[model samples]
Target: MAVLPVCQDCCQIVTVNKNGKIETHSPEPYGERACNASGLLTGRVRDIVVSSALRAHAVRRSRPTTSWGPVRVHKSGLLPRMPDAAPDAMPAPKWLPHLKGGTLASVTLPAAGWLGVWLPGYAKPTQAYRVEALTQRNVTSAWSARMECWTVNNQHFLSVANALMRRHEKILVGREYNPREKCTSSCKAARGPLCTCSCHAKHHGGGRWMAGWCVAEEFGTVVDGSRWHWMITGKA
Candidate 1:
């Protein structure tokens, strides 16, 4: 006798005999109704089974396998792993008073008297001012090539964070379009005014924007297993 698999959906038994013939049977009545009487012939049933098996195989093969387990793929790419926790030596500090207003720029203390500022990109005016401010005060400061942030002493961290916050607010105010403004065809065509709303920023590249706060580990604190916050600027 050949082992048969029961269809859990309909509680019907499907089997392939020794002679390579497929068969399905409807079990006895339960309650007032019998198991689904609907049935498929050998050829049709075999085709459905084979197709389902092939699809399952393909799906399994397509998944990315990691030492931990299989990871599902997303539209952007493979799903990102969770950021590692910050080490005891470097805890996440409270955001500066200026940054608490929900600005894009942020500061992290990777070590005592040392600050790391996350900017949208390298060589922006804000980054230049940060280094300049520290230098003007005769404090140690430089762009960390490895960490990708302007590292300065705590003596000027407050000033740099405040300046960047003000500059960021000014740039946002200078924009002709507000977040509440509806996106227009011109914005889509990249011809006329562009909206600063999240929708427009995501779809049309209307303007540069960054959102979401990051933990200390995601900054230069932990270094090895940290992931940056998702940036709407499309680079992330």
Candidate 2:
């Protein structure tokens, strides 16, 4: 006996024999088992393809919707009708305190001032980061609890901490970019403005009391990782 499954998009039928092997067929033969699997995970071979398709679909669906149907423009610069909100009608971020001078300072930074050291085998850390606190200046206001420095609410303070560290030595840090296959080895993957990959070439790390409270990286690319905050906070 044979089982057939139809592709959801192409409407092409695939044949599966009793041994669970598949073959492509035209006009889908009868007297064979057919499964309606228009919306099912077929096999591991399709995981990546399916993920890419789903991502594209999400991007299409999330696009700005227009009140009117699509418009057609002519060489004369005329349109059938305005399709959506005028360019000026788009929303903007609400007013907030200037980041330059916010009282609370927190931002993820490098561990030991070194940023782009590739984990062995591109290994992902299974545990949280480990942060050690070393205090300088007045003991009365010294940072005692390491956890206090890493909370999301304390992003500003985290920035301050990183700035303080820059005064000491080169910091290891990675720049963030959507991962792409551009940089194979020497250069690491980095996010680009429009989904294209860019070379975030690592540079020498820097140390200094730079801009308000920002750690100056003298070198190394700044690739954003899923565990970036964990790496920065040293929270393990």
Which candidate comes out best when scored by lDDT? 1
lDDT string for model 1 (65-174, tens) is: 12322222224221222111112212122332122222234455332335666543223444556456534567666766555556776555445544554333211111
Candidate 2: residue 84 lDDT (0-100): 17
Among the numbered candidates, top TM-score falls to 1
Measured on C-alpha atoms, candidate 2 has an lDDT of 0.26
**Cα lDDT, all candidates:** 0.35, 0.26
Taking every candidate in turn, the Cα RMSD to the unseen true structure, in Å, is 21.5, 21.1
TM-score of 1: 0.26
Q: Model 1 scores what on Cα lDDT?
A: 0.35
